[model samples]
Target: MNRYLLAGAAAAALALGAGAANAQAKFDVKVGGDAYFEAGYVDQDVDSGLRSTEFRNRMRINIIPSAKADNGLEYGARMRLRANSGASNTRTTDADRAYIFAQGTFGQVRMGVSNSFNDETYVTASMDYLKLGAYDDVTAWINLPSSTAGTVTGNSILNPSIAPDANSTKIVYFSPRMAGLQLGASYTPRNDSSNTDISRSKPTGTLAGTSNGIYQDMVEVGANYNNTFGGVTVKASAGYMWGRAVDDVVGSNYKDLNAWQLGANVGYAGFTLGGSYIDYGKSGQNERTGVFTETTRNWTVGAQYTTGPIVVGANYKNGKDAGSLGTTGDRELQVYEIGVGYTVAPGLTLQAQYDYFDLDNDASAADDKGNVVLVRSILAF
Candidate 1:
């Protein structure tokens, strides 16, 4: 049944585009992309056999084909291909976004692999010094314990929202903005299925005290506000996500997903102040005896000043989650960050950042503190 629904949606979208095409105006194809190269140095308490320096780079291309109908409705499709995965110089490419969209006075509708409404429009702290859309680059530079991976919430402890949907096939709707407010919603059949894959098997939980994060029938609703009152600009976002957990085994007691996000920003006189809170209250943890469960959450606050071609910013982040399934409690992560960026030319930038981080682990031996410095060059067109 779910597969048929997806097929029908694809057919309908193609038909709409075909029937609405204007012979006088052909489809317009455009190409654009961005690239970055970075080098980093790290000093930490646990650096045994770990290299203090590393270099990394990535590139991506966005292919867009769009057209407008005679009645002012616009239709389009976009695919983003990236070369971001490499091990020992072996590189591979993959598409992270592929979607069909149509927009009119009613706003926009997207079908296929795309972000949720909240992921697309949520307002957060202004991070001008960070590269592109990155918020948790520190994770890539530091070694957090492997046991810190799962909480059934955000992709990582530093991520600010619940987006376990993982770019799976979905349908999203965005209402037209009115009086500085906009509303949106999205539905995903399964969090693990994407692209051309069709999954029909029902997910089942492990026995007793084990936990799993996979979910089905994910739904999200969100709203955002954007307005400028006199010399001050105000922006805010709120969102909620919920889903059904895997079917439990005879002795297992698994919890469903329930996560929410709130963020706000205010900017004036070239300075911006903002903060965000994300909460996942034991959303995907097992509740049986002998299993440790805790609230999964993170919050961030920051301020930045932009003057001419230079930008300076700083922020503090705190994240906590349930550690190992055994007797340990929550693990905490804290980071104090400061950074700067300078535009060398139109589409070119040079950036430098320094981060001081402390990790309080459930296991005493895994706890560590570190300082890192990174230099980067970015080009976009």
Candidate 2:
């Protein structure tokens, strides 16, 4: 069946379910979202001598509905829609996320487009109070030179990590917590699903020469534990992802790409500390030889302190061969950041941050340092 049609069918089914819930008066609905704005000044020591001040803003709304069955089973659905300003005075609206889930003592089952086990479970120390803005430090850094073949660009700042495909249809299962431990798993038939249009067709034919379509039959599993010891609370998680090669011209050349991550956090008094490490193994293949030739790894450490309505935090992140794809030369990045967030009122927060990026072996023959200062305001309801 056409995937688009299937998406429509799923939507219809969900609507019908919601209607039935309304008729039975067993439904609960809530609407909430956030409005965010940021202004920042950037300074790059590169040859171009780029120095600029920018302003950006975005808004989103989330609709959530849930119901509980007489047999102690609960079902829920979430849909998020967003509008943001773009370059050249362009604005766009999109359904960022839509998913349905059911849960009970047996555990929980989630279907539709959502985060994978790896993404949902991994722990990190970055202060993401305002994820809509410069949440991570990598954006300030520059990429270095490399020698390996088949270089791919536009890698995520959080490299060596596994994330769900963009709007790819998938199923995820999360086991109920037991003794502070919980497990999760997910499966995706194809990774080329569209986020903006659910009716997009899946890619087919040979993947050898295709610029897109890389993984098939992807599977991910993760586990996390949360517990407190004495005056300190701890949270830790680990995850792994593996997928089968798609449309490989040579079996060996097109090998399965795998990634894993380990993270932990501890909180004591008003202070919290944590770190995470990620490794993406041979995920890139040489475009010429079609052979897997590159790997990426990175780590992050951070600390935060909170008192009253104010929180202050600092973090350091380092990446080796970050986003190098299959290149051979040294590609490295380091980010140091400090920030403070204050609660001005109910559902409103203001934050100020400073970030420094240190780049080495950068592909661009320019200065290796850059800095940014930003102020952000967020209102949620």
Candidate 3:
């Protein structure tokens, strides 16, 4: 009898393992990622002379699991593991983005750390090269002095030419595409919120009469349209964002921040052209008097041509009052880049880019101009 009992237990264990394996087979799961390696030489002529050659590498892995229920509802989750060799000391190689979504006839609802609707729907004329074209350019080669703060370094033009609050923890909804049009909306409880869950308790222990953070309770709405007429394809998008003040630092003088953007792209016969304009509204606050200070604006225009395995692109961007905290007269950046990309294999591409940047400030006599040349290898699978 004891021997028979042992045999029964072994059969049960095998049955349970088979059941679990069959259940897992019902869902589709995929693993993929990309790796990017870049080497560059930078030449600078800012307030002083600087030259450097650098090499950097970044890798990310994406795990995507999805299932389609019998009722026609599809659900999935995406998680990314990211690591970079050239990141700052504070940067961590961890799960940088994780999100889950459900979709069917009612469109898609995504929750967790993801890009806002404005950042998702807004169009740009820049090319999607290895470095994202105008988005990165060559601003890293130049360092401009801060106008308001004492000798603080400033960023390049690309950082300001786009909307703030890129990827944050939020809930987003996207409507189904209808007649070449789609709508999206997102709400974020806090601008600085990262991969953490929303906090129930209000943060404390800040300086008296000052706000806890720059922005809170943000809302973004956007629309995008894409269609092909004749032999040309056209895409356009517009977005608006608003955020409530975290505190009444400036009392009644404080107003909710607002921003908007417009962009369009046209493609024809292996050539694509596009442009975008963004307004970041009023984000600056006077530390001494706690008053709203300055507004920011950015614009870019670019074009690309693709033939077989080679792609070439060029773009120019301008930013005004890029340093939101600085006086209006002390913040302006202009940048331009030209690049070429060649596909070497099914999942590999090589690219070379040349970038130039200029920083101008009426309040400062320092010259901030620089250039960078970069070559990159990208592998995606």
- Largest TM-score belongs to which candidate? 1
Deviation in Å, model 3, residue 269 alpha carbon: 0.3
User: Looking at candidate 2, what is the lDDT of residue 186?
Assistant: 78
Off by over 4 Å in 2: 1-25, 47-51, 86-89, 126-155, 159-161, 164-166, 195-213, 250-252, 287-292, 322-327, 362-367
Off by over 4 Å in 1: 1-25, 86-89
TM per model? 0.93, 0.82, 0.82
**Candidate lDDT (C-alpha), each:** 0.84, 0.66, 0.66
Better model by lDDT: candidate 1 vs candidate 2? 1
TM-score of 3: 0.82
Please state every model's RMSD to the true fold in angstroms: 2.8, 5.3, 10.8
Worst 10 residues of 3 by lDDT: 148-157
lDDT string for model 3 (39-124, tens) is 98877665344547877777889998987765556678888888843356555677767887766666777777776666666788
Give the TM-score ranking, best first: 1, 3, 2
Please give, for residues 1-381, the per-residue lDDT of candidate 1 as tens digits: 544554465455446545655767678999999999999999999889899999999999999999888867788899999995657766888898899888877678888899988989887789899999688878889877766325563377888766778578888878889999999878888888889999977667777545677788888889999999999999999999988887867766777888899999999999999989998877768878778878889999999999999999999989888877674588899999999999999999999999999999888788999999999999999
